[model samples]
Target: MSEKVRLVILITAQPGRGEEQVAAFERLAPVVRGEEGCLQYDMHQVSGDPDRFVLIEEWGSKAALAAHDVTAHMVAADAASPGFRAGPATVLEISAESVA
Candidate 1:
């Protein structure tokens, strides 16, 4: 089996679109969670910065994460970007190592 993939996405809302951005993510959560290989898909809003949101996701593998990028829900989310985003989202892939 391949190693699990972890992704962290930071989304910043446009001047007055924080609520809309949150709503969009809420709508997308279930769809993403239902995809194959998805382990977790959680969203969080920054306590001090209402316009900042974070998405923490875990997938079974790199392939699974790649597959998710082409899904209809993702496409829809990309298409609706202008409605809520202040700019391009920041995405990061993470890996962990254990110490013995």
Candidate 2:
């Protein structure tokens, strides 16, 4: 098996779209968590920023993460993203070894 991969995704919702974005992520969460190689897929809203959200995800490997990016749920999310996002999402990928 390959090394695990961790991802932190930051999303900023468009004006008046925060609730919609949260709902979309809530719907997508279970589906993502069920995917092969998904170790963790958790979402969080910023404490003071109603428009800001975060997704913390862990996958079995880089390949698994790549596969996830192409999944139907992710595809739909990407398709609907422009309507809800204020700007491009920020994504950071890391590994324990890299941080050590």
Tens-place lDDT per residue, model 2, 1-100, is 3489988999999977899988998899889999999999998999988889998999988889899999988988899989889988999986536534
Regions more than 4 Å wrong, model 2 = 97-100
Model 1 residue 35 lDDT score: 95
Residue-level lDDT of model 1, residues 1-92, one tens digit each, is: 34899889999999878999889988999999999999999989989888899989999988898999999889989999877799999999
Count of clashes in candidate 1: 0
TM-score of each: 0.91, 0.90
Model 1 regions lying over 4 Å from their true place: 98-100
lDDT of residue 29 for candidate 1: 92
